[model samples]
Target: MNNPDSLTNHFLIAMPNLADENFARSVTLICEHSEEGCMGIVINRLTDLHLCDIFDQLGITPDKASHANDVVYLGGPVQSNRGFVLHEPLGKWESTLSVTDRFGVSTSRDILEAIAENRGPEKFIVALGYAGWGVGQLEREITENSWLSGPANQDIIFNLPLEQRWKAAAQLVGVDLTTLSSEAGHA
Candidate 1:
């Protein structure tokens, strides 16, 4: 569960000036946020791997309905070897973190098995790793203008082309990322 004011179900848009290689111009979906910590999945960066490759690793045979060729994403820098499935409709799964009534994240093998059989959630994206911040860390970075937070938009996550996501997420909050100066200065 998240606090009412928490960023749990929001999009974390990295400001243009954020030069970190893993997060530059990235859009992350905050899945779990509370006094304990914050965890998110970066939606805009793609890895060279595909879903079938992962199935092979897990020894799950892909069925015809399995969209095994779909590209996988680099969710974040943490747990880079583990797989996560970010899906809509919040279906019942063995191990799922319900981000919201409509969205959930599943790390259990059962969801992956269902996906391999094409019996998984209708809308989903597979990701490896996840972005994480310790207690109060994300807030401090946000105060420093490293990110812009806004309500999560499903279209951007499951529909839009990758190149357009960064701008689209920021646009949802009426922040024209293009107009912001990239230079950071502190008084």
Candidate 2:
């Protein structure tokens, strides 16, 4: 059995051969991983929606016009209407999963309200939905070479542009995915 703790707070960069339409070339941040399963958010898939659109839908008036155009990501394939706020300088919220000392994922409307009111964390990426794996499912996929994981970095999550994040995350483990063969090699 794989150590569940090792998967938490890491980035799961999909292998080039990952044929799943939902996860091709995706970068996912594993927020929690345990015997029960694993949960993560795809950080680089931007949707057509904006922060302002979400705020309007939630009936919260956005306080920062500068942030109105911020992209809202399609976190994963589950709960597409649900919001997940991945942020830093972790703070107490109505419902939050503390991913690390410096990072967290909040699934509460309160956090959304705080962001709209300009009282949220210093750095954050708002996503809708999240990726999930059933018990042993992720481990099996990893063994099949479906992913490459490395310690998650805040800079890549919040600073890098969406298009660069996939490659950047892969590079964390010294992998230039472009140079990798999609076919698995046999010795």
Candidate 2 lDDT over 85-126, as tens digits, reads: 999989989998989877899999998888888888999999
RMSD of each: 1.4, 2.0
Native-vs-model 2 lDDT? 0.92
Clashing residue pairs in candidate 2, if any? none
Taken over the whole model, the C-alpha lDDT of each candidate is: 0.94, 0.92
Which candidate number maximizes TM-score?
1
lDDT of 2 at 91: 94
Q: Which runs in model 2 stand beyond 4 Å of their true positions?
A: 1-5, 64-66
Tens digit of lDDT per residue, candidate 1, span 1-187? 3377799999999998999999999999999998899999999999999999999999999998788999999999999999999998899999899988898999999988888888889899999999999999999999999999999999999999999999999999999998999777789
lDDT computed for candidate 1:
0.94
